[model samples]
Target: MKEKQFTTRAVHAGERADFSQINSVVTPIYPSVGYTFADSHELDAVLGGEQPGYVYSPRYANPTVAALETAVANLESAEAAIALPSGMAAVHLALLGAGVRAGSHVVVAADIYGATYSLVQGIFTELGATVHLVDVLDLKKIEAILAQEKVSALLVETISNPLMKVADLPKLAELAHVHHAKLLVDNTFCSPYLCNPLTFGADMVIHSATKFIGGHGDVMAGLVATSAELKAEMVRLNKLLGSSLGPFEAWLAHRGLKTLPLRMRQQCQNALHIASWLQTHPKISQVNYAFLPSHPQFELMNQLTNGKGGGAVFSFEVRGAGKPEIFALMDALELIQPATSLGDIYSLTLYPAISSHRSLTPAERHKLGIGDGLLRLSAGIEDVADIQADLAQALNKIGHGFDG
Candidate 1:
């Protein structure tokens, strides 16, 4: 064979190097948009789904992303998994995969993530789908709604955001299956380390891998774990929507997932300690940690997680405090950072009224038991004493009599 020219060499210098003999401890990132095959026949076979291979990234898949999907599927005990650009994309794809479409009926938890609420109430509703937002804990109401309509999907968070309300997954799954509806559970809070929703009979398990899965808070990704049949459908839908996870982000998330058990263990311990301490504090009006006996769904949470832990995040109310006082407490904190996100290595605080549940009106928030004085704290793998000290000092700085 003749040597290539300089210009041709520039484009083909390191293209398609074979590493089949190389064994690496970690998965390497594959950034190529297009892949090559030994012959056109093999390429045709791969593209036609007759063989397991990657062709194009945006339309098909990537090696790194596929590795992450496999890992998540194994962790969640699902037959297959799919990675997405973000948590909302996972939710949207899960809904679509469950056969939600125009003229479909979707039953959603009333107090879900703010953006998710808007996604169903605004976009799905505008598309002519009927959405019924009901209390997920009220199984009777859900049964009645299912009986009254031909529902397509029932969506709920395993441990709801901001408030930390645990859903009855087993019962909900049974109800949905009996009604011929698919049940999709957001397992972001109770990660696979604590709970596997698929084992509890859920049709689909969703995760915002940007949270605990990417423990360091560096990568943004989402995941859906389900049967292979459903995964193929989601893959097809995503090919048209172009909401696939990137190779770099997939590599980062996969690395983060390796330490999920360790991170979640310490974070859960710290969260329970903080929740217990806050209950004893005079300024704290309410505490909402499922591990605590005070939580309404404590028993159900234990059954779901098998007492692994109550997760790393919980919400509490500051007595006689509104936005102004809440702001003062947040500003007073030194060790605990006041941030918008949760499930990171750094202990952080978020006010639901302005962050997680901001989309809902005050009346709607209040109706769901999310008050203006509520503050959510995500306990990191830090010392419990240090975290409580920061909260104590912050609480002491703000006076209860302050009005907003």
Candidate 2:
């Protein structure tokens, strides 16, 4: 229990116990909204958190969901983990757990996923939190804000959205601790397989399990891995917020997680090949995969992933392609899915300006270097050659105006 390989932990962690006495190979789903106890005293004990048992679904917890949480915690090497209905819910819970209340200060990455950007700037701000959007790479600026304000949390993505900027986790964690701010990393892009943010001193490691964790796109769930104290706080908050993941979704996510190591290895391999191919293509002006030597944070990425290749997801810019041309290319693709989500068995593509970053204004997006021609791709565990050929044909169709 003290030491296990990542792949072994992936398949075996948080399973084969607790919920069943029948030695079920898989974690069984407990769909009941409430649980029965031996007696009222036992129920009261469980309800008061004096003992470990599920009493309710929405407010308290469920066996299936708890199993998933345990697995995620084990994988991320955290004291505990909580599963939520969606990734945004996990983000919300992490913010609250980090003490992002009214009159609090929060420093967030400017280039994060669009919904996260809106949540910090919109809802958190409306609730009276002073949010500062900064370039996560600029540690000095972040430090300055943290020093000046009583910042509650410093939120950032391990790998930035639309642009594969690798965050220096250890440095950021140190800076946040120095300023008494909690470092909360959204580890969705890298997953537990590629990077364990908590190991680098992050106070909270969050995941949109719907993506890479689920790996099949059938479930919508989120998870937060942190110290047991933080998890307790989130669980208490969830009692009132009611954003916990359902048992069925939890089961689905848990099942998908069993193959995380396997799926990630192939996805990473496919992405590396595709990103390299895209970089050399005349139709691609830029490819933002962190593992590539050309990437700005290639070294940092290798340091973080131990040279596992950037990740399954990466972004690129099409040569002379605007929204219209981007649409043309996506339409021409036969194998790759022109969908919104990523980290599935099938390849997926999204136009950041229209999808993930759509909430931001054109000027705001351009300021963040998310051009209209930018496209985000999540490589699947498919044949690299087939995937490459799909992109090749798509580029050919959108070849009306090219650098060549």
Candidate 3:
């Protein structure tokens, strides 16, 4: 069909376009543990990597996962994609596959997921690689950092969790390429629907498919998108490390993929509405959705959100609040779940200082700008008014026990 468009390919690629296996439009999961080979020649070809087909264990490459990877890769316009058990696996594979070695320098943003920050700072740092943290938006500082250090790769989120900082993908890509360093964009926050880092010259794109790509928060999965050469290395390392996404999780992820477009659009709209309302709310100290006019990155967001709202996550500081007040408001919510993870059908909220980013030292938190009183909101499918009502009630009773 000469299909080259994002939506078209997402629905068609890495799958039997007809999906007539059972007269279903969505791709069906192949739950078999292993595939039966027609003959030894065929089996040899499959094992030898001579042809693309499954013959052995499903974990190596399940039809469902292949379909999911193909769809995501096509949507992101990448050469190949790898699906893993969780987002951490995806990040680990990308860093490992990029050929990071002892004495290599890895550059990361300070405002990363808490676990990831620990992994890079705690493990990779000990393994002989140097870690450099910078605000991804600070091009001047990034340039200076790159100029001073021989960085192996640059890693950042497309739109960061809680913070909603949008990286300048094109500029970062140029900077990386100039220094022979690779750029890996963690697309967990925005996913392919909002931004494809590959289209901007990023060497790789990582996703904790556990987030928006899975849509329903029903499964934990990770994905790596990169060039063919990179994919081969990742696959090799993935197999060696004994980290593979299970067949069932792969199936669930495939199902998740089918509705990513629809889910993301709705969530994006809901988040914008919520962020806008929160900005004007008297109880809010700061609203951080990129689409918000008050956001420092509003102009950049307009240029990069592709006319879509920044994918549904943002942080709002509680006005006149310390840790106790923030906790009170979070606990007061009725509909919104006071949760840690984000990107789901149901709304979720958390305080990074106490939740995800708590592990970091005070100095680290200071550098990352993770405030103690911050309340992050993950807008969901609920009506914006309902979400606001939950928050209003929560806020109403926040200072009720004492004084405002």
Task: Please list the residue runs of candidate 3 whose C-alpha ends up more than 4 Å from where it truly belongs after superposition.
Answer: 1-24, 400-404
Tell me the deviation in Å of residue 2 in model 3. Answer: 53
| lDDT digits (tens) for residues 300-355 of candidate 1 | 88899888899999999998788888998999999999887888999989999998
Residue runs of model 1 more than 4 Å from their true location after superposition: none
Tens digits of per-residue lDDT for model 3 on 14-61? 753333455657667677667666688988999899988986445577
Worst 10 residues of 2 by lDDT: 14-23
Note the Cα lDDT for every prediction shown: 0.92, 0.92, 0.83
For model 3, the local distance difference test gives 0.83
Instruction: Using TM-score as the measure, name the better of candidate 2 and candidate 3.
Output: 2
TM-score, predicted candidate 1 vs. hidden true structure = 0.98
Ranking by lDDT: 1, 2, 3
